[model samples]
Target: MRDVSLLAGVSRMTVTRVFIRPDHVLPETRERVQRAVLELGYVPDRAAGSLATQRSGFVGLVLPTLSNGNFAAMVEGLTEALRTAGYELLIGYTSYSVAEEERQVHTVLSRRPEALVLAASAHSATMRRQVAQACIPVVEVAELPDDPIGHVIGFSNYAIGRAAGDFLAGLGHKRIAAIGASSDGERRDLRGEARLHGFTDALLAAKLPADMVRMEGDIPFSFTEGARIMARLLDEAAPPDAVFAVSDLAAVGVLMECRRRNIDVPHDMSLLGFGDFEIGQQMVPALSTIAVDFDDLGRRTGELVAELLQHDDPSGIARTDVGFTLIPRGTTRASVP
Candidate 1:
């Protein structure tokens, strides 16, 4: 910073002001400083700046996993939004474990971030308390919480599940099976559970026997897991007429497996999935699934964090429900006799 300031013919304070409040500096002076910074490849010490101002200008982002395209997209959207606001994102992956999430939270909080954005609904009461004590803006993205720590900018997983189940039942799929993530690490499991309950109840209400319902697990909400479960079910003497995989990745796997086995989708079996990721549509037979507005989720989270940061009174809580839609495509069809 000192070298850049010298090269730009400005004081160190001028350079600092350029970053913190560029609007205060003359256009020519700002340009000269920026050019000097570029020429010298000099990076300002954001940490030092934070110490001086007590504002980190950084937002801590904690996600359950980067493996899922859905979460990855959400992160991308979030980072883009944060960057536009002149804030940097400090990211951490927790692999969906509450303990791991708590540990990551502690590590991120140590950095004194201006705000925090969590990908999943937190499970640990201790962790929740810790975040509250941090006294920073905390926003939970992707899934709605029963008790949000600060602000929420996501949808109800329960509603997504129920919607998927209702759509499948309305299509007259009497014997429905659900393939879901078996890991207890993520609150996403609650989505699978809710979908399962909704599917079963909807079927039962239609006079379909509860015994007709089949479920399989030991998956991590991926395409590979979905395919594996479908293979196991197909190997059985009586396969389900329709199956709902909790994730689009899993549904794609199911579709691939059916193709390999020469099983006709919506003819021999129907499939439904969640997330409605891009891959779902690119497949040979497009997936029928529940779609969450991940981009909206990201934007809303950013807005909520900004609100919490600017407000003196934290008493007002904002819960934005980014709703879900069921995309009916080629995968699910009317049951065949």
Candidate 2:
């Protein structure tokens, strides 16, 4: 900053103003400073600037993984919103482990972000306590919590699950199975567990035997994993009448496996998936799944962070619930004898 200011015939304060309040500087002066910065390859030290302003102007974002398109879309929404609001985002990835989340929380907090946003549902009590102690605004995305640490912007995965289960039961799917991720890293597991409960409860309400339902492996959520699990189920002597994959990617895999085996979707078998990703509707036999407004979720998160920062609230705020919808497509139908 000093070198760039010197080369531009300006003071260090001018450089600081360029970053924090560029609107205050004249167009020619701003251009000269930027050119000097580029030529000198000088970078401003965020840590020092944050200390001077007593605010980081940086929001910390932590998520399970970016490999999922849904998550990627959420991130895109968040970064764009934050950038437009004159803030930068600092990101961290927690592989969906409680312990890892705890560690990442500490790491992000150490940076003194203006606010923090988490993708997965908070699990560990210790981790929650740490977030509470941070004294900064926190936003948990994707799934809402019964008890939020700070502000929450998400929907009810349980409700989504129940909706899917009831839909399938209404379609007369007596023999159903579920495939879900076992990892605690994702809050979507809560959705899976709730879906399983809803699926079983709905079947029982219809006088179907609990034993008629089958559930498979507790692995990471992925399309390939969904495909492999569906293949195994298809190999069984009495295959399930329908299958529900916790994620759209998993559903895609199931569809692919069924296609390879020459099985007719919604005819020989029925399939249901969650997360109405673009691919879900684009696939051959469009997936019958739940659609989550992830973009809205991200926008709400950004708004919450901005609100908290602007207000500088110490008492924190209440959790916010977004909502979900079920998208019924060609993948599910009445079981054929």
Candidate 3:
């Protein structure tokens, strides 16, 4: 900053004003200071500024996986919204592990972020304690929480599952099968488990036979695993006329397996999935699935963080349900007239 001021023929205060309150500086002076900064490749000391302002000017964001496009879209929305508020995101990945999430929370809190955004509601005991102790605004995204630490922005995974199940059942399909994560040690797979439960509830509500609803798959949710599960289900003595996967990737995997086996979709079996990922729409037979507005959820979470930051109130509007939608496409059709 001193060098920039010297180069721009201005005092250090002018340089500071250029960066902090550019509107207060003359346009030409601002341009000259900016040019000097660019020529010298000088970076402002955000840490020092934060010490004086007591504002880290950063929000920590924790994500489960970067492999999922839904999470990516949510990050995009949050990034844009936070950027608009002059705040940056410090990202952390938990890899679907509760213990790892606790570690990540500790690491992010060490950075002194003004706020934090988490991907899911489920958190380790240590993580919850650390977040509560931080005294920073926290936003939980993707899944709605029964008890939110701060603000929650997302839809109910079980309701999404119920909606998908109802849609398939309403299409006249009686024989239904579901594939999801078989394990939930740390409730990491809570989203998938909830969906499965909701789907079974819908099946029972419809008075479908016990034999008509088959819960298959004992592996984690993944494309290849979904394909393998679908293949194994097809080989069973009694195959389902329709299949619902807990994720869009798994649904696509099921479709891929059906294609390889020379099985006709909708004609022979109707398929549905959760998380209406983009690839599902571009498939030869468009996928039918439950869609959540991930970007909107992110935006709302960001907005909530902004509000909390400005107000410093934890009790203000603790939750926001972004909701979900059921989209039917070529992969599913009416099983009977």
Candidate 4:
């Protein structure tokens, strides 16, 4: 800044304003400062500037994984929204562990983000307390927890599972099954478990057996795990006529494995999945999926964050439920015989 200001024949404060609030400077002066900045390759030290402004100019986002397309899309949308609001996004991945989630939350909080956002809301009590004490607005995305720690912009994972179950059950397929991640250990996907529970509830409510509902596997499960789990289901003496995977990643795996085994899908078995991934659309039998507008959810959450940061006083707690849709494609037939 000092070098650029000297070259531009302006004070250090003028250089600062050029980057922080270019609109405040005259067009000719701003153009000169920008040229100097470019020539010197000067980079603004945001950390130092943040001390003077007392605004970090960034929001924190925690996610289960970065590999998922839906998650990537959501983050892209979130970053776009935040960028338009003059903020950046700092992200951390927890790999589906509650402990890691707590650690990442603490790490991001220490950075003094204007707000915090979590992709999933299975927060530990300690984590929740820390977030509350951070004195910043918080948003829980992709889930509507029974007890939200802060503002929520998400749909119900349980409802998604129930909808999947109801749709499959309504197809006259008496023998139905589901596969999802088990939350028995600390490294868990609690949202997936909630979906499984909802699926179970739907099955029981319809007087259908929930025995075929297999709750086993781990996070980041796609083709290998999906195929592995599906193989187990196929070995059963009475294999299900239809199956639902908590994630489309797993559903794709199941579809590929079925193709390998020469089993006709929706003929010998029907399949459904969640997360409406692009890969599902390109699949041969184009997977049927429970779709959530995750990217839109991220954008909405970003807008909400910007809105929350505007007021000094804590505003009313807001909860937004972005619902899900069940998209039936070639993989799910209208009926099973």
By summed lDDT, which 10 consecutive residues of candidate 4 come out lowest? 181-190
How would you encode candidate 2's per-residue C-alpha lDDT over 104-152 as one tens digit per residue? 8889989898889987565689888878888877888887777766677
Residue-level lDDT tens digits of model 1 in 116-168: 88865545888888888988888877777787776778887767766766777
* Candidate 2 TM-score over all chains jointly: 0.88
Q: What is the TM-score of each candidate against the true structure?
A: 0.92, 0.88, 0.92, 0.95
For the record, the alpha-carbon RMSD of candidate 2 to the native fold, in angstroms, is 2.9
What would the per-residue lDDT of candidate 4 be over residues 51-104, giving only the tens digit for each residue? 998889999999998898888988988998888878899999999988999999
| Ordering by lDDT | 4, 3, 1, 2
Give the TM-score ranking, best first: 4, 3, 1, 2
Q: After superposition, how far is residue 195 of candidate 4 from its true place, in Å?
A: 1.2
Best by TM-score: 4
lDDT of 4: 0.89
All-Cα superposition RMSD per candidate: 2.3, 2.9, 2.2, 1.6
What's the C-alpha lDDT at position 233 in model 2?
81
Comparing 2 and 4 by lDDT, which wins?
4
Best by lDDT: 4
Question: What shift in Å separates residue 273 of candidate 1 from its native position after superposition?
Answer: 0.8
- TM-score, cand. 1 vs. native: 0.92
Show where candidate 1 strays beyond 4 Å: 184-188, 210-215, 334-337
